[model samples]
Target: MRQPGGDEDGTEPGDGEPGSRLAALGGLHLEEAPPDGGVPATGRSPRTARNRTLIVSALLAATLIACLGTAVHLFLRINEPSSAERPPPPPPPRPGASMSGPAGGGPRPVAQPVRTENDLDMVCADRFYPSAPRFRGSAPHPVMISEGEETGADFRSTRTLNRAAFAGSATQRRTWAPDPERAQIVACLDLTGPGRKIRDCRAGDGTLPLVEGRYRLAVYEVATRRRILQKDLTGTDRACPFVIRTGAGDTLHSAVKDQQLYDLLHQRVEG
Candidate 1:
């Protein structure tokens, strides 16, 4: 059992002992010496600690710089508008030519009697009652009606009183003259119906003669001849044609140039 040399703890040392012998062979004293080329057993090497501290300090500096920049930007934004403030704009101008009366040297003009053509134009549309009798003229048969679309922009219905003429019961083709020229005789409408809305007229001239009498004319549709929308040419003519937009209660008075379309409307009304 006991062969070679007895070890320190009463066990034989093998050809290669585990710890102290190996250290000694490699030039290290177990209790005192360090391995070959190894650092001393003091604290830590100055260079390693310095490098780690430098890296941590660099990261911390970067974080502090980013925070400071963000704070500065927020502060500038908050102060810029208040420091460079601009005043509110002035109120808009008043509408009419003169705020005072024409006599006060504001907008001077002599008052004159309204002429015949002016009176005739005045007969076109009356704003007070949009679908009432707007034109009160010397014409024999006065026709009033309302027609036009109901706003927005879809297929909607419109209505108008084209013309109304009283020609003494005799059926005859008549020649009517408007201010500009001799326009063809279109359909005449009779506003004998229960409901009638008269609108204002936009007449350029206040002194135009409209023949005073009942008339018979043909109402022709410029668009389609479908019986459902065809007009009759045997009624009174408004001083002008008025267009009504659906939904919105706004009314539009047509110009004399638009009488042809009015003629069509007259047919629709009467028919």
Candidate 2:
């Protein structure tokens, strides 16, 4: 039999039924609900949402990579040395010393000092004329000779002597002449000897004289009072008769027929 306001199943229309209870519990609606009554749609599809998420993730990854790269660049720049901050290069190695190794290794040969002609000239000028002195009159001092004529040739001879003095064969101390500008009294030959009358000896002022028969030749060191050579020549048997007596009293006679000394004297006389 049918009941009032009940269905055939014997449950009332609005009563707690299985379908209604399920609908209430599940919060589902069979018909479309009002806009303000149910959960609202996000107005975006699932695929669209996923795509937006992937785009954001990609942007974040790129930004992170850029920051890491920038940090690495900064680190490298800070560690690098600038030109001014860098240490200076080492100096060049000295002569005769090996760049590598020590003792027992053969020492490298050292280069000898080289002297030029101009250097020799300057040395001669200094040795010949050291200082200026007042003479009796404007008549250029009798002892002072023209540097251009007298000293030039003598300079050449002195240059030769300098080389000999420094050579390994030299037995005397290596010495050079005084500055010519400081020299007051030039070297002069004392003609009060018998050899001067025999040879008709005539030497330019400030020149070394060439004499014959028992003559003495002496070379006084320029800077000091030391005498290097003092020779006494006697007899006429030798062609260019001359003798060189060292300070040690060792006597060296010139070659019997050698004209080297004569040639040197001729050059001085001509100049």
Candidate 3:
């Protein structure tokens, strides 16, 4: 089997075959066989992959635990009541008792009386007319006639006076009179028939006289009514001058002669 220029042992020239010579020149060596299922084709060990998986799983478990703890904390915070959501405290008990009732057993504190302007007006009205029966003598003193021209004999002769006299009921005359505390008397007169006699009654007697023609006196309160003096002479001559005492021990005199009262009444009635 020896070819031409070949050795007798089937060996090529130059110490080995051409492939072996190339292998030796390239420094190649025989590789050992790998054990079954020991290492993958990717050259990574099975134990290394398992370790990486374990580390990833441990990290995921830690993240899940942290998220669960945060959710629980948030749930508790949302469910708990804040200070602003809490109920208010109860009010303190009254001094007299723990519960309201009759005196001593569970006494209720007495409420103090409150006086209003309406109450004061009511009181002033009541002072002029009382609930109890009063005789003509016991009633408010009549206006006195000191100095005035006595023209007519009786006040009923005047058409105006006659109409006013019969206008009210007997019951109203008994209990009703102008409130003198707050009202101001604008005019006082003693009249006779067709002849009109105007007199300055302020200098005269305190009592307003009702005699002769139409005896009419205007009494008014500017605060309650817009005009103090009536627009027409339609009422009886029963108004008189009165004195009111103030809390400061001063006496306030209200009469027809007051310049302020005369001006205000004249402005309203005349204008």
Candidate 4:
């Protein structure tokens, strides 16, 4: 089955091509060149090419991300205000604002309260029973309750220096004004009217009377003339009004209650 001008494998020899002649002579096999204008062989493995492609793609992605971040940062900086907003300054104070106080911020003098026509000022000084009354055996200490005070003077619910009240029948146990010869303590509560007063009438002395009442509860020792205690009494309506409300007096007395003067003379017998 051999053709007349062909080899055993039916191949042509010396067909006017160098590759064909070399094949006809046998043994030498030359590699064919790739097609014209094709890519040249670099002899690199597929793994190497794949790795290079991955590196290039990563570089491109990084560059894109960096550019996007830069663009966002610039946009934020451009849209912001130049500086932060601030509050307006306060207005200046008016003239003579500090004239009520002392100059150069010294201690400001407290202004005394002005006495109005109807104002009742019955404030009195404070003193306490620092020492208990001493007793000799058991003779009742005689005390004189204040009487014939100024018309408008009275005692009410205790205030300021007051610690008790002098209610009506609940407190009037004994005589109002006892004789000074029989009494050992004179609970004298004198008064001076807010209105104008004249001199002494019985003897006709020309000296002016007091303006305001000295609202006090002064307990005096009869023979010794030593002051036991003097407390400021609370007044009613105007200063030191005798009658206001009815009860067991306004407050509790430290030493005596009920008939405060009588209770003081009778109960406070411990020395």
Best by lDDT: 4
Off by over 4 Å in 3: 1-42, 87-271
lDDT of 4: 0.39
Task: List, residue by residue over 1-271, the lDDT tens digit for candidate 3.
Answer: 8878666877766567677566654422333225663444445566888999999999999999999999999999999899899787886753422111113432122232212222212211111122211222332311111111223211111111222223565432222222322222112232213223333233224423322133333332212211133222321332332432222111111122333323433333223
lDDT of every model, 2 decimals: 0.33, 0.34, 0.33, 0.39
Give per-residue lDDT, candidate 1, residue 203.
Answer: 34
Which stretch of 10 consecutive residues in model 1 shows the poorest summed lDDT?
A: 120-129
Q: Could you list the CA RMSD of all candidates, in the order they appear?
A: 20.7, 22.1, 25.0, 24.2
By lDDT, is 1 or 2 better?
2
TM-score of structure candidate 2: 0.21
Across residues 114-174, which tens digit of lDDT does each residue of candidate 2 receive?
A: 1322322332233211123322232221111112112112222222233323443323212
TM-score-better candidate, 1 vs 2: 1
Residue 104 Cα positional deviation in candidate 4, in Å, after optimal superposition: 43
Q: What tens digits encode model 1's per-residue C-alpha lDDT throughout 160-229?
A: 3223323322221121222211111112222212213445444344322232222222232111111123
Model 1 lDDT at residue 256: 22
